[model samples]
Target chain A: MSALLTVEGLRHGFYGVQVLNGASFEVRQGTVTGLIGPNGAGKSTAINAISGALLPQGGRVSFAGTDITRLPPRERVGLGLVRSFQLARGFPRLSVFDHLMLYGQGHPGEGFWQSLTGGRAGRQHEERLAETALSVARRLKLDHVIDNPVSALSGGQKKLVEIGRALMAEPRMILFDEPMAGVNPTLSAQIAEHLTALNEEGITICLIEHDMAMVARLCDPVIVMAEGRKMTEGSFAEVVADKAVQEAYLGVRHDA
Target chain B: MLSYVIFSATTAGIYGLLALSLNLIWGGAGMVNLGLAGFFAVGAYASAILSLAGVPVPIAILAACAMGAAAGIGATWATVRLRGDYHAIVTLGFAEVVRLVAMNERWLTNGTDGLPGIPAPLKSVLGPQGFAVFYLCLVLTILVAVFLALRRLDRAPFGRVLKAIREDQDLAGFAGKNAMRVKLIAFAVSAGIAGLAGALYAHYQSYISPDHFQPLLTIYIFLAVTSGGVGRPAGAFLGAFLVILFLEGTRFLGHLLPGLSSGQVAASREILVGLAFLLVLHLRPQGVLPERIRPAPAQ
Candidate 1:
């Protein structure tokens, strides 16, 4: 499969300390790509730069063969590339349904004047979006709490809301920043099942995860990052068995 | 006494208009527009100048709205990247600069002397008492229209985008929403509302000065929004009226305590207003009427 996203020579720093130093990788189309590294491996930063949330100091990011290095996050999303947060960020006061509806495809009554003086077409569009949102909620088992404010949701449920929001965008590729972080094991497995199900449906995904077992289960062509750069790329088992990947996670012993 | 009540109510209506605008930017979009007075001054002066130049009052007010929108968009564009407290400081500075320009630019603003004799709409035909009643009706009509329009906008997709941006701008951006454009439009509409209120104030009072567009007016509006409810349009309207009542009621203190100097009475009034604001915040941080999420339609 061809690469849907390509990041080369990605570099970033904060206050003179580098976080992402020449990180390079590619997420192939229709694959659940895993990005794993030790603490401070710049895994989050790498996805952020690729997602256009944080502009890298130096790099090239091509999405669907277009060089989108300088595109804003909104434009990137318009191109069908979307990302989720590590901690499930959302509008606190917005209900789960509204949150999903806010990210619906094709803004219908979104114009300044059109919103104030809404028409039959806008109402019709909204009704269709409501149905879509309802389906997404039902799929995620969030139908019961569809009208509950996002802040009132449990951590696991909020994580589901984030996924539901991404789904609402009808994205071609989704970069998830630890979607299962802080989630219980049962929900984590459910999220794993959802990711597998989504991958089967042809949506490309790149995920940053610390749960090695979950990563091993869900990811293919796993890319291991160490010291802000891609250390190795292979199947999960191959990367795990590599000496360099082991050393990166566990420091070299001076006594030996 | 009836006239006084009518006059106060009319002024409160103007404040309600201003409060509504502020609520859109501050509550809906999560922008701290401390330079609301700048937009107010821009609208008031634009209308006042155009009217003085023999333009029709309605046309002048429309021009003022345009100018206010331009000012709001320009100001927001310049400082959109500043986060949180920095944005507030820059907006505060913007208001100060506007005040200074109004103070120094005698060629346009007539310096600190200010412009007088602003022509009131329907003043000649209705006469004084009738005009007062007519003007009150006009202001109330405009306020209610704005209130209804804002409520509609708040329920539409536009308002949902604003709320998403307010919660987390980056998340909203990733949702394929242009947060910058949304915020710019929000600021423009809000500034237009403030501008409209300013024009109305100029016409009603038939006089306006830099003193009338004080930063203190912005603070009072903030207090009113906080007291009423942050995100609710009805809360802003009620809060404005409540604030005006408190402000006017304080005048009785000087009459009751004749021994107190006028300066002392003024100081005490400030203290009393501050105490009232604090009491409201202490009791209801969410305001008197917190924002309520609308219920979902039945599937």
Candidate 2:
């Protein structure tokens, strides 16, 4: 399979405390690759470096064979490399529909002067964006609360909205940071299914998930890490069976 | 008496415009722009100087707007990298610098003597009293245009993204928004509006001075923004109108306090304005009209 994302010798730290050290991995196109690690094993740091959230002091990140290590996070997003937060960031005062609308691209009506002169083309653009926003809201089952403030959303619903926003960008790849956190089992399962559906439709995904069972069910070519370095890579069963992976997870019995 | 009411209403509209401009920065973009009076001064002075140099009134006003936008963009370039309170402090200092320039640059601003003979378009056609009425109408019309522009922004996708950035800068970036560019555009546009209001004030009064753009002017705008509500254009206009009413309403205090001097009444009115803002903050922190997020009903 062709690789869509590649990281090499990435290193980052905060205030003299190193979080990611010489971490490298590849996410192939059209697959959900999982990154698993114990606490402080640099999963988030690695994702941050990849997504341009934390510009690494050393190492390189390439997307679709182009160097993007120094690109600003916003520029990276414009190139269709997007990322989501573990806590599911949302503007509390904005409505769910507004959150979705904010993510709509190619609308000149969002410009200051263009907004004043919103002609036939602008109105049509808005109508199209509205349609897409509606479809996204419905797909996420957020239609019920579409008019409500984001503050009113449940934790699981916020996670879904976060994903919905990423989808609005028409992403090529998404780096998900613990999207399953704080979600009920059913909702989490639905999230996994939605991700699988996305993968089937040719979107590359790299997620940092703590739930090993969900990871085993959803991700192929699971990447494992220990002490901020690559430990192993294989199918979930193969990685879990590896002695190094077991010891990294403290004999693999502690979690169960 | 009716004319006097119109005069007061026109003044209120000017304040409304000023308040709304500041609201764009503080409420929409979550950036505290404390140099409001600086932009106002730039507009007033640039228009005054240009008109005195024989430029037409409309052209002078446009130039003032450009000058204000430049100043706003310049301020952003200098300090946009600074986060939060630091940006606020730098903007506050900016207003003081403009005031000092107006004071020290006596050759242009005429120092404390102030600029007289500021041109008005209708002054020749309508004559003094008729011009006053016509000017009020003109100012109100400009306020309406400004109101419509700001109101549109309040509901537009651009404003939504601004609020998004206000909530989470990191996430806004991931949403493909160039946060700094959005902020600069919003901030500069706001400052340009403040400049427009200043030009109106200068032309209406037929004079301009440094004291006219004092930091207290910025304070009054902050009060208007807080009292009317944040993030809503109507709130900015409403708060400014109410601020004028509360201050002007004190004119009737002569009957209630027979022994009080007009001077005393004026001083007390200022105090009352301050106290009313404090009370509004304590009782209704959201202003009289709180922010509302426009959402299309789910179909």
Candidate 3:
């Protein structure tokens, strides 16, 4: 299968130390691709580079055959590539409804002058969008708090809201950064289920998770990285059995 | 007393316009605009110069808004890359630069001597006796129009995106929002409104100087927004009224206290206004009306 997203020689660094060094990987279309790495590994940085959040000092990222190396995150989103942050950053002051309403493309009311002139047609369109937002909330079990400020939500709910927000964009692919972190087991499982359901609906997912059990269960053709380079790419079992993988994690010295 | 009421009401209306603009930027869009007076100065000077040159008032007002928006765009463009306090500091400096230019360029602004005899166009149409009343109505109408427009946009996708931008710009961008672009629109619009207010203020007062457009004016608007409720339009409106009254009510202290001089009364007024601001911040940090739980559903 053709790759939906490809990262070639992704190299990035902070002021002094390099975090991602020549990290390269391929995400197959419509697959739940897992990017797993140990601490100080470049998994998050690589995801950032791929998502256009952090521009890589050197590398190339192509999405759906389009060279997006220089595309801003906003334009990348317009092209149906969306990402969620490690900590769900919902607008704390906005309601659950506003969260989803803020998404989508070419909202009729986005422009000040257009909204004023849009009149009844505009109001009707907005009603339809609101109903859709409400239905989406109901699907996510967030209908109960649809009118409440995001600040009123629990951590797990916030994560769901984040995912819901990504869905609002009608994205072809979602880059999730630690969606399972700081979430309850039940919600985590629910999230896993939702992700699977979404994948079943033909949406591709790239997940960064510390939950190996989930990575094992959900991800296919797992890609592992260490110190900013792809260590190996294979099935969960095959990658685990690799000697380099063993050395990177355990630091176990082997004599020639 | 009637004249005082009309005068006070007109002043309050102008301040209300300024407060509404600031609230939209700082409160709604979540970007603090410390250089509000810069835009206001730009609008005032632009309108004053245009009208003095025999340009019609409407055209001059529009020109003022255009100049103000241009300045707003310039300010945001220069500082868009900065975050939080850095943006604030840069804008504040922008206002200072405006003041210095006005002060130094004696040939244009007439330096500290100020521009005098600014025509009150309303007086020409409505006649002088009821001119204050007419002027009051005009400013109020504008305030209401701006408030309504903001209220409509507040729920629209633009305002909703602004809310998102305010709370979390990066997340908003992640959802495909052009955060900077949205902010630029908000900043420019807010600045335009403030510029409009400055034009009205210059014409209403019939004279303006470099000292008229000061950081103190910006501070007053900030005080109004904080007191009224940061993101609430009605709160901003009410805030302007309350603040003006509170500041003006202090003027009565000179009359009440036998020993109090005019200068002492002025000092006391500042103290009281400061105290009220601090008290509001302490007691009702969200202002009288907090940001509402329910936003309009569509946006």
Candidate 4:
């Protein structure tokens, strides 16, 4: 598969504390790429830079042959690249269906005049989007609480809503920042299966995860990051065997 | 007595329009527009000036809306990056500046001497009593139209996007909704609504002054929104009327404090409004008729 997203020399800092220091990587078109690193290793910062949540001070990020380094988050989403937060964030009082429908593919029926008039075309578009939202809910097993406010949902369910929001965008690639963090093991397994199924459906995913076991099970060509840059990349076992990886994690020098 | 009642109702309708405008920015999109009085003053002054310049009343009213929208856009652009308390403070400052300009700019706003005998629309076509009733109908019709438009907006995708942004702007942006553009449009539309209300007020009263568009007026509208329901149009409409009634009802209580001066009676009314606001906030923080949307039926 071709590279769907490329980040070259990404450098960013917050108030003089450099978080991402020349981190570079590529997300291939048809694989679930795992980005694993220790705390403050710039995994989340890289995702932020790629997703347009924050602009990197120095970097060139190109997605699908277009330079999106300066594109705003909304425009990036329009180009079929979307991202999710580590913690689920959404409209507080809005129902799940409303939440899903609000982020519908291409933001249909959102024109100001069309909204005011409620023309037949807009209504038809809304109905179709609603149908899609219902199917997404059913697939995520969220149909039971589709009418409930997202704020009232369980943590795991809220995580699913975060994924569901990305799905509604019809994204080609999704950058997830710890989607399964803080979930119970059983729900984590279910989330793992959902990610697998989505990956099978041709959506590329670059995940930031701390759960090494889950990363080993779900990710291909896992990229290990340390000290704000890519330390190594290989199959899970191969990277695990690297001395540098051991030293970065265990702080023990493995002289070979 | 009947005429007084009709006049009060008309005034309430005008305020209802203002409350609706406030609700759109504050309740719909989570923007605290403390400069509402500034926009209101812009509309009133724009219409008054145009009408006094021999321009047609209808055209002048439309121009007033445009002017108000311009002010909204300008204010939003200037403070685009400010949020929460910062936004509120900046907007409050903007309103004060507008009031000061009206006070000092003698050539434009008459330097607080105020504009008098502003032409009332359709006044010459109808007798005084007939005009009052006719004006009431006109205001009512406009209010209903605005209310319906806002209701349509509440259920529409535009409103959904607004709610999304209101909840989490960054998340909304990730969802491909342009938060800034949406906010600008919302502000312009909201300010235009305020402007329309102001023009209607000027025409009905046949006079307007800088003192009329005080920050206190903005506070009253904000109270109406908070007490009724923040995000609900019906709540705002009813809240305005309810607030006006409260202000008017205090008149009867003034009789009980018979020894108080007229100034004290006015002060007591303000104090009463403050107490009522605190009571509502303490009892029903989400507002009397909190925002609630019925789920769409199963497909």
Model 2 per-residue lDDT tens digits across residues B176-218: 7888988999889999998999899889889888889889888
Query: What does the lDDT read for residue A149 in candidate 3?
Result: 89
**CA RMSD (A), model 3:** 2.7
Candidate 4: list runs displaced more than 4 Å: A250-256
Between 1 and 3, whose DockQ is larger?
1
Query: Runs in model 1 with CA error above 4 Å?
Result: A14-18, A250-256, B253-263
- The true-structure Cα RMSD of candidate 2 reads 1.7
Q: Residue-wise lDDT of candidate 4 within A1-256, one digit each (tens)?
A: 7999999999999999989899999999999999987888999999998999888999899999999999998889989998888988888789999888877765447988889988888889898898999999999999999999998999999999988988988889999999899999999999999999999999999999878889899999899898889999988898888888887863432342
Q: Is model 3 an incorrect, acceptable, medium or high docking prediction?
A: medium
Q: Pick the candidate with the highest DockQ.
A: 1
In the range A11-116, model 1's lDDT, one tens digit per residue, is 9999998998998889999999999878788999988888888889998999999999999988888889989999888888899999999888677788888798
Off by over 4 Å in 2: A250-256, B258-261
- DockQ of candidate model 2: 0.70
Q: What are the lDDT scores of the predictions, listed in order?
A: 0.89, 0.87, 0.86, 0.89
TM-score of every candidate: 0.94, 0.96, 0.94, 0.97
- Higher-scoring candidate on TM-score, 3 or 4: 4
Candidate 3 lDDT by residue in tens digits, A40-99: 798988888888888999989999999999888888998889988897887787888888
TM-score of chain A of each: 0.96, 0.96, 0.93, 0.96
How would you order the candidates by DockQ, starting with the best? Answer: 1, 4, 2, 3
For every candidate in turn, the CA RMSD to the true structure comes to 2.4, 1.7, 2.7, 2.1
